[model samples]
Target: MLPVGHFAGPMFIAPDAVEPESYEVRYEDGVFSLSAAEYAVWALAHGDPDRVGSHRPTRQALTAEAEATGVTEPAVTIDALISDGLLALIEDEPAARRAFAERHQLMPLALGLGNQPSQLGVFQIGMPNTPRVSVGYDIYHMWLFCHRERTLWAAVQEIAGEAQEANDAAPAGDVELIADVDDLLAGLIEALPILLSTSCGFLDPRRPSPTSAPADDAAGSGDDGRGEDPAEDHEHGGDALVAQP
Candidate 1:
């Protein structure tokens, strides 16, 4: 008998989404859209495929769970997701644990902050015991956590490797290291879309909250103190002024 599996890795969830009536999942070139009813079953059983055997729920049980979440789908999305490799069923508990740990062998060598570039963090979504995240900042550092960290880094390395021939023309010494660093940054930039979808950008404790509402003074900039609409007053059109840097 084929055992059930959950999502192969973590994916983002909307903070406002409790039990989505419909869900659309996109991975690389693969896009799987789910209706709200179908998605209820999926959401109920998703996350932690490796441990599914320990607490297997019957399709009937899943249907009830879905209905409780306000969904009435008959649980068709489960089979579809398992077939896509988006969810992989691992029957061995110990083996799955080993697989998860051995998957990523690299760690951050150092940590610092700036407007510069590095691998962004990967986030796990809907995982058991893990808090749901919705931070949307594109942090320059690898501060998020995702199941695909090593896979992404490996791809980045291959891309950056293509630039080695150009670096060979320069004098050796530290040039190789510098070039590699440049390549790594370039790779991160290239992988921006992947990171954005798969992970949550982390917020720095030092930085002010980006989501804070604008103050009264800043919000009404260019408007009269009486709260006139600046744009409305300029119906005659305004001149385009270029400012010096």
Candidate 2:
């Protein structure tokens, strides 16, 4: 069974004009018209839909929020949303590392870094068919690992190493860099479904190709399939390894 942390995928929700207290939610290719009670449950689970990542809510928290909002049988409503693919229940970080990331290759659909320093490395990443999303620096850095021929865990280690090197001047402290990296990895795992569904990215079973060439070699290397941006116009089909929430 999937773990308890539930998160909503990329979606847009607006109030329904004809139906009072209802919502019209657009996710991927489908539209969900949610009644007030149902919307209450979903809204509680997904705070600030405009944010790039999904809101991670525990089951108990979701139920309590639903009850507070006067939604009856809140669990039933939450389950319905899960079944409808509007919400994905993510596994805890440890389990996700074992089951998802370690087993799948995170292939980007389109990834570009922000040009301005004020943007803090965040970028508008997109898939062939899905809307672009604002991804933060940490997540963006992690995604960059996809270009290299290494496991996601290896990428985490690399990131942690970089952090360690940057702080080398400071005396050794109790900070556990791996733990911090794991926390960031958890966010990526939680966002996996939305990433996969939108075709903004995918988790491949096959081994990744060699690390991409440097920017200077990009122009002429186009003839070599290895030079293509993984995110551009790549075909997306078949069943998703990760289930939609």
lDDT of 1 at 118: 48
**Whole-model Cα lDDT of every candidate shown, in order:** 0.33, 0.50
lDDT (tens digit, per residue) of candidate 1 on 1-245 = 11121122222357774443233433222234444433345555432233333434444555565556665334444455454332333333444423322322112211222221442333333234542332222222233322224333443344345446556765766334223533453333333222222322210001112354322322122222223221121112111111110
The best candidate by TM-score is 2
Name the weakest run of 10 consecutive residues (lDDT summed) in model 2.
234-243
Report the Cα lDDT for residue 163, model 2: 62
Model 2 quality (TM-score): 0.42
TM-score of each: 0.29, 0.42
Displacement of residue 192 (Cα, Å) in model 1 is 23
